[model samples]
Target: MREVMGECLPDVVRARQKKAFGGVQGEWLRKYHKRAVYGLLRSASFKKREYWNHLALMRKADAFFAGEGENSFFLWQCINLELWFRKFID
Candidate 1:
């Protein structure tokens, strides 16, 4: 995960420089990451999808946190999860 994020950091930095950090660019990035995380979670050869379940639970926790108070944290979690999925899946 660190390696993938490291590789993607350049592009993310570029996007920030271009002020393309939101709207469509942001949406696309989010989707890409979500897919990558999902793929990673699904990659284990084990019978139980533990990683996938853990990720899902984390997402739910993020949602709950957002609802309770930490809106930014929730959004960050969501974006992180999506990015994770995108990086791993593709």
Candidate 2:
């Protein structure tokens, strides 16, 4: 789509800077990492069978809140997996 736009647009338009889209959730999560810490810590699935290092999750959460975490997408995946297990698994 960007290529098509560049081709169709004038050289002047094409020369302008391009911005990356979609980081609203990442921004929000970073800003509100403290609020999410409790939920991450309360992971039942994460506690079972050592599938994931529970302490590592806490460290990641801490890193996120401290603005040192660069793996927002991975954190989100971990959260989703925990939620999914709670919702679907007996």
Deviation (Å) of 61 in candidate 2: 1.3
Cα-based lDDT at residue 4, candidate 1: 60
CA lDDT scores, all candidates in order: 0.47, 0.71
Off by over 4 Å in 2: 1-22
- The best candidate in terms of TM-score: 2
Tens-digit lDDT string for candidate 2 (4-86): 79778888878778978765657767666647645656656566725688887788877876778576777787777777776
lDDT per residue, candidate 1, 14-68, as tens digits? Answer: 4453333333433443445455534533444311433445555556544543454
For each candidate in turn, the TM-score is 0.24, 0.62
lDDT score for residue 11 of model 1: 62
How good is model 2 by TM-score?
Answer: 0.62
Q: What value does the lDDT take at residue 70 in candidate 1?
A: 36
**Model 1: residue 72 alpha-carbon error in angstroms:** 0.3
